[model samples]
Target chain A: MINSISKVINDVGLHARPAAEFVKLASGFQASIKVRNLTSASAWVDAKSIISILMLGVSKDHEVELMADGLDEELAITTLRNLIESNFK
Target chain B: MHYTLVDLLKSEHIMMAVQAADAKAAIELLTAALVESGYAEPEFSVDVWKRELAFPTGLPTQPVAIAIPHADPDHVNNSAVCIGVLATPVEFGQMGTDGSIKLLVNIVFLLAIKEREKQVAMIQQLITLIQSPALLAGLISAKDKNQVLDLIQQTLNEEHK
Candidate 1:
């Protein structure tokens, strides 16, 4: 298991499009991924569920923790962290 | 910020047994109804259909298949929701699927949100009100326009309260 902390930089935070992109990427990996908004009251939610991420209602400049566990934990955490850092580009 | 789902819906905005051929058509039918009923502008339909093509809203809600199609705020005038019940299920791509996957959708929720900030919060609220099987069953079984409104209002109030 591995985890990384990152902040949401996009203007929309994790709203519709970005949230969908993040979930799509996270769903591709075999590792179990969960995300929690550190700056908000949201608990850890399944990163694969777009509904879960959207329901978090995370706004810009919010900090989040991404955790991954299973076969490709290291790769999942690194790649997801990069995705967030790049603002889902 | 303080509006109920019923506030955005009207009988003219509801369609039963809609026979749209595909996802785009489904969105077009609903958005057109909203536009005609003064809830949105004429361009809202085209923009919504385009967005639907790109990011399908077909949610895998149980008991009855549903989708929520929305457009950019620029194309909207007033916030509105148009509901449609399909006679036969239509194929709609699921939201957030990268490669491609279709969900057989029976109900459509076409949204025209004028305020940008309200959209996310509204979707979140809708997620809570919509994920219930009993509420969805009520919506699916509604026989009249009043029944639809009552069921939606009852479920939303029950869920949010």
Candidate 2:
């Protein structure tokens, strides 16, 4: 199990399109992935669910925690972190 | 006074059936309605269409599919969410995919947000309502604009309480 915290830099945060894109990528991995918005005080939610991601109420500069525990934990965390860093571009 | 989303929806006279050939038409039709109601400028529709081409708002929700077609704040005169229930679902590219993939969208939640910063918060509330199967059922089963508005108002207000 591994987890990391990072801020959402996208203009819209992890809402609609960006959240959907992140969920799509996270679902491709075999790891059990979850995300929590530290800024919003939201609980961890299934990373593969776009709607759940939106529930985090993440806005730009909102810090989020991503956790993964499975065979692809490392890969999942890396890719997910990079995706956020790239602003979902 | 802070206007709630429901208030904006009602004041703008948004929420209606849309008969369009595709997503582009649906967006145009909704934005045109807003313009006719004196909510948005005429150019807002065109800008929204372009933004749809760039970053699709199609959300592949369960039980029912929906989309949110919107543009930059510069194009809007007032912040309103114009609901357009497409008679026939149209194809819209998935967001953040740069148009590589598409989804069939039947409900268009065209957002006329005057402030870009507020868009995320509004979407969060909307997604919360949409995440519930029962609420989604309520939204999908609504018959007309008033019914849709009622369902939304009831649901959103319930969430607050």
lDDT by residue (A1-89, candidate 1, tens digit) is: 98899999988899866876787788789987888889985566668655557866778899999989999989888988888889878
lDDT of 2 by residue, A24-69 (tens): 7997899888888899786666676554566567899999999999
Runs in model 2 lying further than 4 Å from the true structure = A1-89, B117-121
Which docking category, incorrect, acceptable, medium or high, applies to candidate 2?
Answer: incorrect
Per-residue CA lDDT of candidate 2, range B56-156, in tens? 67777877777877775666787787787777788988753556678988777787767443444566677677666676667666777677877887888
| Predicted structure with the largest DockQ when compared to the true one | 1
Residue pairs in candidate 1 whose N, alpha carbon or C atoms collide under 3 angstroms: none
When summed lDDT is taken over every stretch of 10 residues in candidate 2 chain B, the lowest stretch is B115-124
* Residue-level error in angstroms, candidate 1, position B58: 0.8
How accurate locally is residue B92 in candidate 1, as Cα lDDT from 0 to 100? 83
lDDT of 1 at B155: 81
